[model samples]
Structure formats: structure tokens, C-alpha cells
Target: MDLAARSPAYEGLAIELAVEDEGWHDAGLGDLEAFARRFVEAAARRAGVPDDVETELSVTLTGDAAVQALNAEWRNKDRPTNVLSFPIRQLQPGERPGPLLGDLVLARETVEREAAAEDKRFADHAGHLLVHGMLHLLGHDHIDDETADAMEALEIEALADLGIADPYADAPEHL
Candidate 1:
């Protein structure tokens, strides 16, 4: 059975959580509902998905070791990244999405460290990654210049909806 069919709070968005990091608990980021709502709302707004449409995804919060393994296995990278996204499927414009959009894996320590280095609030940085991962699930990519521009613009706009500044603004010469 579909998990969304069994839940009441899935009013168009459902996020299954796999939390393996204790840091999230300390940072008050372990609230799956709050983070999920922020991510899903940002994605839906950018993708033109209506508020009443049902959608779902999964999020995993883990330590650097765990994320490093996934990064090596998935992207041939040996180091830990702040976030990694696995998109389940692609949807055309105006098409209804399935129950699962994709999975987002986050490295707790890496994210925290990056936020501190960048002089950003942890929640804001985390929110930016969630928005980024959510966009990837919706078939947005940054593989080329044009797509990267589009993707970045969408990300900036969606992050604005969450009251987050454009994460790329501080990037040197980036939009």
C-alpha cells in the first residue's frame, strides 16, 4: 500500500525520514515535518505543482562516514558532501508526480561545517540544500550553462519563498 494513502498529514507532500545523526537532534533539525514542509513547499512552488497535488519524497540525515560511503558509491567521490540527491523518476510539465519524488541524503557534520565557514545560519544553509535536492528530484539539473542558469534561478526564487537568501549570491561571479 502507498504510505501516503495511510497518512493524514500528506496534504500533497509526504517526506519519509531516515535519521542516523545525533547532531540533528541537538540542532533541532530532527523535526521531519518542519523540514519536509519547507523543502516540499519550495519544490512545489518552483515546479508549478499546485498546493493540493500530492507528492512525496524521503530524506536521510547521517554522519560524514555514512555520506562518504554513499558519495563514493554513487558519484565515485571519496569525500563527504553536504547533500546528495537521488531522483527516482522524471515528470513532464503538467504531469502528476508519483508518491515518491526521490531521496535526499545529508551529511550532518559537513553541512554544519560549511554553514560555519560561510558565516550562514545552519538552518538557512540546510534549507538551501533541501531546496536544491528537491529541485533535482523535479528533473532540474545544472549539467550545462543554460540549465544551470535556469536551475539556479528557480532555486533562488523558491528559497525566497522560505525567506532564505539566494544561496549562490555569495558565490564568486555566479548569478
Candidate 2:
């Protein structure tokens, strides 16, 4: 697709997608922009963001190699992950942010493999990850048990809005 094929804006946030992997073309995931907006709005609402939260969230669809390189460079992990969220800046309480909401990088291969292994539809898993990533961009984290619980619950709520089942409901041990 070319520049003219860019998706329309959702709510006050503009979703820009960059598909770098050929495999993504045939992934059967439909209307990614709409999905991103749906989850993002839900996440922002859960985060207490106002209805007029204007921002641009760039969603890059790439492969495991790209994600692994980023993981290694930024998180010091030499492994491929499903998604990475890079928030542009941290906003203080009662503070407004700039137009950019940072970026979300997704590994198509890793996400596909995980969905298959977990007996989930790829789109559903992607929704979960997308919400998780957006939450991260909104300054949510899972660094500790308490924080993890809150974040996971928020993820579950967002997924529910997308009509996806609770991801952790069927999660295997050691996840």
C-alpha cells in the first residue's frame, strides 16, 4: 500500500500503520486501524484519559528480527517479543501531552506463533497485545506483582471490549 492508502483517524487519535513484513498482508487480520482505535480508546478510558485525548500512535508491523534487535538494544534482551511500546514522554498529573503518543512495534512472527501455541485466533491475540502495548505507552507496567495484576486486569478489560476472551483464562502455567 502507498501513502494514499493510509487509514482514517479514530476519535481524536490518528493511527498510522507501517507494514514491513510481507506475511502481514495475508494474516487475515481485518481492519487494523479500527482495531487499534478500539483498544486504544478503551485503554485510555481505563486510564482516566479525557474524551479529547489527541495523539498520533504509530503502529509498525514487522518481523521477529526487527523486534529482537529492538529488544536487545533497548531492554537488553536478545530475544524476539510480541510487541514493544515506546512512549514518547511521561506526563505528570493534570498535565497535557504533545501530539505524539510514541510508537508500538509488533513482531508478526512471534505473535502468530504465540497465538497458534495458545490455541487462539491471531487477531484476538493481537488485540490483547495491542491493548497491552498501548497501556504501556500510557505509563502502565508490570514490574511487580501488584503492578502486574493491575495492568493485566486493564488488558483483560480492553480485550473484553473487543469481544476477546480473557487471555489469562486459558494461559498455561509459567506464563
**Clashing residue pairs in candidate 1, if any?**
none
lDDT (10s digit) by residue, model 2, range 49-81:
666667888999899999999999999999999
Best by TM-score: 2
Q: Number of backbone collisions per candidate, in order?
A: 0, 0
How does each model score on lDDT? 0.79, 0.81
lDDT of 1 by residue, 1-175 (tens): 8976764433778778888987787876567658767766776678777666676788888899999999999999999998898977876534566877888988989999988988888888888888778777877778788888988888889888878887887876332
Candidate 2 C-alpha error for residue 5, in Å:
28
* Cα shift from native, residue 108, model 2 (Å): 0.5
Clashing pairs in 2: none
RMSD after Cα superposition, model 2: 6.1
Error of 2 at 158 (Å): 1.1
* TM-scores of the models, in the order given: 0.85, 0.86
